[model samples]
Target chain A: MSSDAELIGRSLRGDTSAFVEVIRRHETAIGNYLARRVGRQAAEDVLGDVWVAAYESRATYDRSYPEARPWLYGVALNRLRRHWRSEPAEQPAPDLTRLAHDWDPWPAVDARVDVQAPLRRALARLKPEEREVLGLVAWEDLTVAEAGRVLDIPAGTARRLLHQARKALREAPEVAALLQVPTT
Target chain B: MDEMDLMKKLSDVPSPSPEAYDRARAVLETAVAEPVDTVVRPKRWFSWPRAGVAAVGAAAVAATVVMGVTGGSAPTGTSTEAASPVVESPLVKLASEVKAAAAQPGDSSLVIATKTAPDNSRHVYYTLYTDKGQIFTGDSTTLASSVTRNDDQATPYNAKVMAAAREAANGDVEKARIAMITAANNALGVGLDPAAADKAWADTQAEVAETFRKLGKEVPAPRPRPTGKELENRINNHLWSNATYALVVGAANTEVRAGVLKLLATIKEVTVGETDLDGQRVLTITASPDILGGNASAVLTLNADNGLPIRDEVFPAKDSPQPSKHAVVSYESSRVSLADVAAGKI
Candidate 1:
């Protein structure tokens, strides 16, 4: 049986179905990634575009790396950039209504951590690119290097950006206090 | 929350509304759609009575001759007459001229702005430029990839090379076939069925070339000319091969065809004609679609001598409800030049 990597290789050769398989495999992760960056409403609008773009551009995909997720992320990131460009510069504060719209906590583990509102406020203060790196880490669970691949930046540069962004947030007194808070 | 905790929370975020899934699904459906086949395949090309399986090649060659001879004599039917010598309708003429320019020796480039209606819903515009050997595209996607092949030569667009090659074939018929073959083998991003793609490319090129030559134009020297009936046989082979592939790949689904055509219809047809703009021999083309409703046409001015498209005036369809009623979506040069593109001149 050809591994996922082999199937990707087939797709590169002209088997579009192989590429389609890749999408079917990773769409959930990609959906989650977009939902985090652009939120649910716009995320849904842009996700299909991301998949289509990825499918259309499958020829340029660098297959040395087996997992197609990073490349798919790159496509999703580009769509997000265009979407951001079309929207107004001063984005509205991420309110509870917005957060609740996209996310709901798992009631059994930990209820009522309303800290997301404050986090969103702080996130709004960051540069768009900075927010991207932060979201990839804190939302997408991407390693710095993987995120770098997705962003089409060098791993070292991604690490540096992550370090700077982390330091800035860690030093923010409110975030620092939140960091210190022990969960039950 | 720690970064990991936050990351987990972000990943698990729920969609805000039910409509999100529907919208995403629509894009996915559009993404999977294909063009060309959507226009019911006329029992054969334009539905000329089917030539025998063995004589299809000879038949296509004969058809080309008949078409050429019949050009002036055939009673004017649906073919739109040239607007006027003074009024100057040059879109088809420019398309031919550009095809000729692409054929000349040294590397040449031109930019084309394409819009397609995947369905009746919306029209998407993409500005694409190509050096005779490579193409650079910008539109819905950010990466500059090949419309032909996935090879290293493809650069930003290695992924969709095969599809691009097929599209090129549909556009110019001759040139696109050659380029598509090159893409099938060399394009890097995806694995192409090289044997099938290569055979298809070679056969289609020869068949189209023969058709063109029989119509009385000089056979522009192909790299390695295949034999006479070889062209005919190849085209037939290709059609059957493609048909087989489509059938096996399941291209019969009507929704897929309808969706793709609907998308293609959204792109207004652009017709370029020779004219004077700023003291230059410019080809001015107007883009419009019948159904998009009111002023969905854009007038573009290109350098006629060199076939470079420069300026664009986008007007709302006469029925447009949008505010900028009849306005121009502009460009910087007569043709989309690669040098200018590299400098972000667009």
Candidate 2:
């Protein structure tokens, strides 16, 4: 089978069916990406816009990259940003209170006591940019280089952001306790 | 937890439903096919139409001014209120009421509607839309029915029309109007460009003129391209008719029904009056003849207390083949459980 890059090249040359194939390949990943950030309902609404934007801008895709997943992520991120800005500030993010529910993987009872609570707080405290880069690595399974491409930042910058985010989490007393990491 | 562990937890967040993914894919496919510059955003229900009225009305005034200066005999009998810049809030209030009623959760929505066919036979349809997205349809005349779980099959209404109504009710009236306009263009197979008003007018006029010529009728003298007001009115008429159909046939959810009501309120050409339906007091809302594209007009009668449609009446145009005939489709809606529908209890 031709690669995603090849499909996109064909799409740019007027083969819309090729683009549909590309969408089918990435829809699940992209849907997951959106659901995680914006919750499922809003995520579904944004997903359509992401694909449309990607299709319209397919001509500008850099063919050097064999995979279009990172570029698609970038498009999704831009749309998410726009959605976030447009939304009223008073509206709370999707219910993450469930995150603290009993799903602790740690064997120790003491360690199991609401580890996700502090982790959620720690995740929220990171600067938006750092959180985004960390999310790409941790949640989306993107490498620092791939995350950099998604965010349109240099790989070094993405690495620095990810490192900063990890350090911030480690420095937080609650997070450190949850992770059982000794504070320096 | 270590970074990998934290990442694992994050990944544990539930994925979007397959249905959502399918819907998004469909939207993307449709959008890609028709490459328009505008992005379809979730509209805030009531905000859209107010702005639309101002913009379209301004264009109409500008067109009128240009015509006067050029010494062209301006068309007589066009409503000057078309140029009125004030936004009416009565429709907005009614829309809110309808939307509130629609939001009440239910297992299934049952629509009992009777349509008078061109052959003068009245057919009653029983459509049930479950909250689970399943649809069961039956009719009185044919005694024929089917059950399907497809979203597209739940209602025979236009998706775009329902979407516009939903947006309008959600307070994006202007966005809903744009959506309606887009739907109208799609239905008419004419591109009504917002930026290129003259071109839209020229294309529409040319198409109409050609149709007239094909009928061997004398083509009238060519006129100036339609102003934004005229175009807005045309689209709003289409929107109103489609919205009415959606309410009676396809509105499975209250939000959608409410949106259609809200969108309907934005059209100034529609007049709201009071009448008796089956000896019960109802509000009768009628669209103007011009908006309906002929001498015939559409009247939607709704239960005043609940805002649910009671009946839909289509008055035949003066030149219509059935000039003396008018069609009335009465509606009865209720909440029913999915199991009951499955058991054929409806």
DockQ of structure 2: 0.16
What i-RMS does each candidate reach, in Å? 11.3, 14.6
Candidate 2 lDDT tens digits, B1-346: 4865765675654678898887677655544432111112111111111121221222322322221111111121222322223266445566667665535555777788766443333446676655555455555321122442221243222456667766776755665765654453432222333334444445545544553454344554556544456645555555565577557654556766777767777678888887777778778888765565444577788877666788777676676542323667778887766655555565
What's model 2's lDDT at A136? 87
Q: Score the docking of each candidate (DockQ).
A: 0.18, 0.16
For model 1, state the Cα shift of residue A9 in Å.
6.8
User: Ten residues in a row with the worst lDDT in model 2 chain B?
Assistant: B41-50
Superposition error at A180 for model 2 (Å): 99
Fnat per model, in the order shown: 0.32, 0.43
Candidate 2 TM-score, C-alpha based = 0.42
Which has the greatest TM-score?
1
For every candidate in turn, the CA RMSD to the true structure comes to: 16.4, 22.4
* Deviation in Å, model 2, residue B41 alpha carbon: 24
Error of 1 at B77 (Å): 11
For residues A73-167, what per-residue lDDT tens digits would candidate 1 score against the true structure? 88887666545443553765355334323332122112222346545555555555566676677767788888898887889988888877776
